[model samples]
Target: MALATCATVAGGMADFLVARAMGRMGGGARLPPRVRDMCARLGRPLRERTFSCVLVLRLLPVGSAMMLSIAAGLAGARAAGFIAATLLGSLPQTVVFVLVGGGTEVNHQWQVALAVVLFVISGLGGVWLLRASRIARADRTT
Candidate 1:
């Protein structure tokens, strides 16, 4: 479990570094106009609330991890805050993954069910957080 957690963090950190570098090199110019617009919309909130935005993005399974990292980097998020949020937000999914992986070996139905439940809860929470962030951003603009 500790190894898995460490590996996940390392991978996330690497993704962040790559994105940050790309951002520094005008990566947005390579993206499609639509994607650039979406990134701009998302980027504002991410810039204002770096930690929470990263945490919510990590929790939500909808978007590409690499894209999120890129958007965050382009938004000028601090590395320490981004990494910390990624680590903290990844805990729920990590727990679910560990539980499901171990349960599969033992063929435990209940454990699998619990893992599913946790996954559902995490998804719902991610949605809620995203919505709240959007609303907060709207409020701030008004």
Candidate 2:
């Protein structure tokens, strides 16, 4: 758990630094049109709800963490808020992975089962969060 926490914090900081540099360098101009469009869409919510958006994105296992970091940077999120949210959101999966990995070495079936259950719940929560964010975005636009 300690190692995971440290790694997550380091990784989040690294991502933020890289993305912040890229944003300063006008990196978005080099992106393809489709990616730019996607970024624009993603950026809006991040701008509106910096911490929650970062937390939700981090919780979702589907997207690339680097991409999210870049998007948050481009959207002008503060480093402190972004990093804090990333660490908080990353705890669930980190715990699950640690438990499952340790459990496998000990051949603990219950531990593995609990990890799977946690993973499923996280996925569901991510889906719900995405849907809610989208709805809120639409309402704001209208």
Candidate 3:
């Protein structure tokens, strides 16, 4: 458990550092004016709530870890805040997965059952999702 947590945090920090370096070096790219304006507007909120946003993103299994790290770095997040939020946020999912995967290969019945149940739930939920295109169409009609 401790080992898993440490490894996860270490990996996250490493990614964050590399992305941050890229962000620092890439700051001078000559983006178009319209795109640059949009980016500045969107990046404002991220800078304001760096820790909370990163922590929330970390908690979810969204699988865009590199992107988030890069964004955070680009947004000029403090190293301490990024690392702390990452450490705390990595706890729940890591522990759950470690526990689920800790079992021996021969006794994998429960793990399979749990995976199927979760998959079914997610599939069913996706069926009724309110898409952005639908919302935009409805708003335009109104």
Taking all chains together, each candidate's TM-score versus the true structure is: 0.83, 0.84, 0.62
Worst 10 residues of 3 by lDDT: 130-139
Cα lDDT tens digits, model 2, 17-119, are 7766877898878867865665677777776677878888778877777777777777677777888888888888888898898897666988889988888
Best by TM-score: 2
Residue-level error in angstroms, candidate 2, position 25 = 1.8
> Ten-residue segment with the worst summed lDDT in candidate 1?
133-142
Per-model CA lDDT versus the true structure? 0.77, 0.77, 0.60
The lDDT of model 3 is: 0.60
* Candidate 2 residue spans exceeding 4 A from truth: 32-35, 134-142
In terms of TM-score, how similar is model 3 to the real structure? 0.62
The pairs that clash in candidate 3 are none
Candidate 1 residue lDDT tens string, 60-124: 76677666676777777778888888888888888889989988866598878998998888889
Better of 2 and 3 by lDDT: 2
Better of 1 and 2 by TM-score: 2
